[model samples]
Each structure stands twice: as C-alpha cells, then as structure tokens.
Target: MRKKLFRATVLMVVPFFASLLIRLLYVTNKKVFHAPKSVGSEPIIFACWHGELLMLPYLYFQYRKTPNAKVLISSHFDGLLISKTIEYFGLETIAGSTNRNAAKVLIQGIRALKDGYDIGITPDGPKGPRHEVADGIVIMAKKTKAKIALFNVKPTKFWQLNSWDKFIIPKPFGTLHYYSTSEIDVSEMDIEEAKLLIKEGLLKHEA
Candidate 1:
C-alpha cells in the first residue's frame, strides 16, 4: 500500500513539476539548432547520450513535436518518473533496458517505426559507460530501414549531477545548444560501422 501510494503521488506530482520546469527554463533560455528544419521533420530514430536527457523532451517539444513519438525507457524507478514526465509532453514510453529485455524493446521499437511513430533512444543509458554506443540502436535501424539522427544538448551554464551519466540541469536562464547530424543511412553499413558512425555524430561537437 505504501509503495502504491508513493508511486501514485510521484506520477501525479513529477509530471506537473517537470513540465513546468521545462517550459520555464526553455522560454527564458536562448537556443541554437545545428541542423535545418528538414532534419527535424524526418521520422528517423533520435539518438543521444544519457547525460543530455535533462532537456531533451522540452527540446523535442520545441522543435520536433511529433505527437506519435515513443521513447525507450528502462523499467526502473527513475524510468517511471521520466516516463510520466515525457508522457505529459505527448511522447509515449517503452519500458525496458539495454541490459534486460533488450530484444523485446528492439522489437517494440521496430514495430513503432513501422507504424510511423518516431522513436527516441539513449544508446548509452539505463546505467551507462558514459557515451558508449550500444549496437541495439544500430540493429533496430537496420531492421526497420530507418535512418539514425544523432543529437547532443549543451548548456552554457548548468548543474551536473554526480550520477553515472553526470546528468545536467540547465540554470534558470542560459544558452542551450542542440546539435544534430544528418540522417545516417544504415542500409549499407553493418551494425558495428553504424554504431561507430552514430558515436561520431553524437560526439562531434563535444569539447
């Protein structure tokens, strides 16, 4: 009973506060996008590092705004909060992790793609070795014949958490830059090559 109540309260309160914070910070902050509008329009797989997830949902809402998008999330306690938060912004969640139920999640992602729902994934997530690229994302793209778009969010001023990903929280008013690479065609490349390409695209602007 206690666990259920706690979960219910978190679901209700977290989304409201998360959405409010995202909107407030976004409006007050200046934003820069590296790619053109067309890149944002494509329904390809959106890939980013786990550390940069703090402002990603808001960034997607601001730029992509795909109502049918579904994000890959782990089936952990933290994932529960994040799933609820992103759902508030109209993005669905697939609860599973790379280390567990990976095949199931990949299948779900493929199906979502086939159904024309945009897919978002953090390749190095749900307990990460930092920004290392996992092959699951590449394989999903290969199976679905969907292109991959690598992105990174950098804030001029922010707080970095002590977590594995070193999660970031942008200061109330700061410059946020969203960088993305051109859609990567995975048809020709094998999984390993695709992984390398995505890693490069995501880390290209990192100093």
Candidate 2:
C-alpha cells in the first residue's frame, strides 16, 4: 500500500513540475524546424532518438499540434510517468514496445493512423543499443503509407545522463536546434534500407 501511494504521488508531482519546467524553458529559448509547411497538417510518424525526448513535447505544442498526435511509450512504470507528463502538454500515449507485445502496438499504431493520428516513436527505444534504428517504424510506415519525418534535436547546452542512451537535458534557457529530412516513403524501400535511411537522417544533426 505504501509503495502504491509513493508511486501515485511521484506520478502526479513529477509530471507537473517537469511540464512546468519544459514550458518555462521553451518560451525562453529559440527553435527552428526544417520541415515543410504541410507537415503540420499531415499525419506523420515523427522519429527521434530516445535520448532526445526531453524537448519533444514542447516541439509538439509549438509546431506539430496535430489533433491526434499520440506517442508510443513502453508499458512500464517509467513509461507511465512519461505518458502522464506528456499528457499534461495535450498529447495522448499508447503503451507498448518493440521488445514486448510489438504486434499489438503496431496494430494500435495502424488504427491511430487510419483515424488521422500522427504517432511519435523512438525507433531505438524501450532499451537501446543507443541510436540504433529498429524495423518497427519502417514496418508501420509501409503498412499504413504514413510519411516518416525523421528529426533530430540539438541543445546548445545540456547535461547528459549516465543511462544507456545518455539521456539529454537542456539547460534552463538554452537554444535548441531542430532539423528534419524530407518525408520518407517507406513503400519505396525494404525495411533494412529504410532503417539505414532513417539512421542517416537522424545522424545528420546529432549533437
């Protein structure tokens, strides 16, 4: 009972504060998006490295405010906390991972896309060999014909965590640079080629 209470409290308080911090920092910083104007209107699969998730919510609110923008999060306790946090910023979450229950999540993603939702995924996530692209995003794009917008976020000043992905946190009031590649048509390439293409796009602006 005590453990449950602690978890509940953390879920509520941490997201609240984290959301506030993100918003505060966002307003004080500058960002640029290298995407087409039509990007805001189309349902796209937004791919970024797992470690670069800290500022994504801000990007969503500022630019990609698709009505049905949903993020793919793992079905784990940490994912729960992250979902709660991003929810405060007005994006929905779907809980699943490539490492577990992948088919179920892929089906969910397809359904969301059919309903005109833009999904966010960290292709190398839920446990990473750091920056390695996975096949899940490629498969989803192929199945749904959703354009994949591969992007990277670079903070001028930040701290890196010791975790596997070396998670990044931007300093309060630092500039963030955003870059994206042209929309990828997964149907034009096989999964292996698509993965390599996405990885190359992401690495172009890696910080």
Candidate with best lDDT: 1
State the C-alpha lDDT per candidate.
0.84, 0.83
RMSD per model, one decimal: 1.6, 1.6
Off by over 4 Å in 2: none
Model 1, runs deviating above 4 Å: 40-42, 61-66
lDDT of 2 by residue, 38-108 (tens): 55466889889999997886555545554468899988999898899898877898898876899999999
Clashing pairs in 1: none
Candidate 2 pairs with clashing backbones? none
Q: How accurate is candidate 2 locally (lDDT)?
A: 0.83
